[model samples]
Target chain A: MRQEHKETMKRRRRNIKLTVAYDGTAYHGFQRQNKCVAVQNVLEEILPAVFGDSIEIAAAGRTDAGVHARGQVVNFFSDGMIPIENIPKAANRLLPKDIVVTEAQEADRDFSALHSAKSKIYVYQLYHSKVPDPLLHRYSWQYEYKLCLADMRKALTLVTGEHDFSAFRAAGGALGMNPVRTIYEAECKQEGAMLTFRFWGNGFLYHMVRNIVGTVVKVGNGRLSPDNFAEIMQAKDRNKAGKTAPARGLTLWHVNY
Target chain B: MRQEHKETMKRRRRNIKLTVAYDGTAYHGFQRQNKCVAVQNVLEEILPAVFGDSIEIAAAGRTDAGVHARGQVVNFFSDGMIPIENIPKAANRLLPKDIVVTEAQEADRDFSALHSAKSKIYVYQLYHSKVPDPLLHRYSWQYEYKLCLADMRKALTLVTGEHDFSAFRAAGGALGMNPVRTIYEAECKQEGAMLTFRFWGNGFLYHMVRNIVGTVVKVGNGRLSPDNFAEIMQAKDRNKAGKTAPARGLTLWHVNY
Candidate 1:
């Protein structure tokens, strides 16, 4: 009877999971770095106190510096001793104000944060105001251009399909990684003075969404034509793309698994 | 005839008016002080260089330390011959990047920015997020309150008409200033995670809008009821009002004459 109880206890202790959101401006990225602010570093430091053990977590994606996340998923193995309902409150108290564990749940032992993702949505915000509002200075990129919404929409239509987006990938990006990806949707809209570019894809290449946004902005500003965007894509040369937009405006909107 | 021509030229040169916008994070306020960064000091230094004569600008309203402005109006008398069209560009070239002159126009000889008869509008922005977005760290106040819209709306109704707002005025405010003012409109709206408070009035006493916003927020958070707000206003004592909200979120939206 004692041996049977030990087996049941082991099975219940390994199914905990956590999902988090963070403003990445203060961290180097999602991964831990020596003497650097990182999402993982903050999580690791607090998880030990909550679970009473050194816990290892796996993130859905590794984000770059200054890249914010709204629904970034993370999973970890933890014992069932602590109630799952109290996980969010317990973690939040130990974490910095810039990061929060919005939700937590119990997951199967075989679940992995990386392999569970099916699609992701990203948004890039741009401000075409003559003078930047101090309130929105950090959340958006201020560009003094008369953006044409029709032109941006026309250019976006060219990117919504399976394509080897070599033209949009960052130069010297991850080696041995395929540049091809399937984009489900892409569009741009302007509300008053704020312009937003939203994209959904099965996966994104390095700097892919930002590069696409930059080229679309060029089309909006009359610097490039929509038809020319098609040509640049066909060229499959990274240099043929327009300049990359700044990182401040990019946000990981959601991750669908 | 030559003397008359010279007098006419001098009269034309003496009328100067400018429209300025500034990020108030780095300044002590709009007024000049002995040892502080003030918007007025920055303008005073640049105007003389542009006009080739000493000029004193009369502002529509004076903002406190850390308060921002977008449509601030100022008129000055200068005995110089700079073209009105070139004034905006010249002032922008000399001023810091945080300040900009969007428009400059010649004003009538009798025009005074302060004495103009019209309404003024102010907006206060609040970010109601569980975790602070790093990008918005300096721009908004991070408050984790489930604000009640209905209660806040009802509380605003009491202050719509002309009334002596002595209860909402700040201590050590300007002397002999009548607290009676007409509030033309007050609105509260929420977009995504942001809450904005807009007020249009014939005039505002020192810290009037901020104190009102604080009280309404208390009502929204269930700390003070809508009916209690009426009681506070009727008491006509500053001690009865809620605490002053931070200055960074307050903006002088516009001044009309």
Candidate 2:
């Protein structure tokens, strides 16, 4: 009877998941690295303290340096018994103010954060003003140009369908990886002097969204024609893409399951 | 004729005005202090470099420490002969990224940045969430409470007319001064998980808006009835008000002349 109780206890303690949000400006990335600040490092340090045991965390996506996340999903396994209601407050006390665990829930043992994500959304902000506003300097990229809104919208429409986005991938992207991705939606809108570009996709190639934004900005500024955007995608040449937009302007808005 | 020309040049140089914006998170306030970083010190250092003369700048309002500004107007007198067109770029190059001179124009000789303003608008942001997002830490105050939107709106309306808001003024404020001020409008709105409080008035006393927000928050949380807010105003006692909200959440949104 005692042996049976031990086995049941072990089975019940094996599942836990947490949804986190972080201002990634201060970390190297989402993955852990030696002698570098990463989101995983922060979680590793705080989760162990909260759970009273060393915990391994798995995330939905590994964001790059200076990329912020609003809804980053993470999962972990734990054996110690603690009320789930205390997880957010307990973890927050040990973690820095820039990393917050918004939700914690028990998951099935087979659940994997990375594999379970159905889609992701990213937002890139650009401020089209003659002069940069000091308040928005950290949150947006300043583009001092008169943008043609119609041309930008036209270019954005072409990016919505599934396509070989090799033209938008970075030159240093991984080898033997498929660059075909289905973009559910791509939209550009201007609110006052701020231009926001929101993209939803099944998955993205390395630097795909940033490069696409850079190309669309060129179209908005009349430097590149919107009609040529489709041709550029068909060519599948990385050199045909515009420059990568700065990472500071990019935000991981949400991850959908 | 040379003496008359010198007088005319001096007169023309004395009429200089600049519209400025600053991210006040890093500064003590708009005014200068001995051991603190202030917006005035930044402007003081850059003004002489841009105009090549000692200039005294008077602002439309004195924002406290950690308070941000978007359209804080200033006027300065300089005998230097630099073109008005060159002032914006030249000063911006010398100033830090947090401070910007958005518009520079010649003004009437008697114009004062503070006295010439007709009205000022201030915005205070409150994040009404169970947990604060890391990205909004510097820009908003996090409060965990279910706010009654109707009660907040009702309390906002009570403070919209001309009155002596001594109850809203900070304790130990200037003595023997009339706290009477005309509030053009006071509004509260909730967007998503954030609540915004905006006040437009001819002038504000020390910590007045923040004090008022604190009182309104009490009404919002049902700690104080909305009808009681008028009684608090009539009492004209600082002790009758709620706690003072932090300065970081307040912004000098704009100045209307």
Candidate 1 residues lying further than 4 Å off, grouped into runs, are A1-58, A75-101, B1-16, B22-29, B33-58, B75-100, B127-147, B190-194
Candidate 2: tens digits of C-alpha lDDT, residues B1-257: 97785455456556788889998988999998889889999999779877777766789999999999988999877877878888888888999989999999988877778998989999999999999898888778899988898989999999999999999987878967789999999998789998899999999999999999999999989988987888899988788778998887899998887
Candidate 2, residue B216: lDDT? 93
Residue pairs clashing in model 2 are none
lDDT of 2 by residue, A156-208 (tens): 99999999999998888895899889999999878999999999999988889
**Which DockQ-derived CAPRI band holds candidate 2?**
medium
TM-score of chain A taken by itself, candidate 1: 0.91
Index of the highest-DockQ prediction: 2
Chain B TM-score, candidates in order: 0.93, 0.93
Model 2 residue B191 CA deviation in Å: 2.5
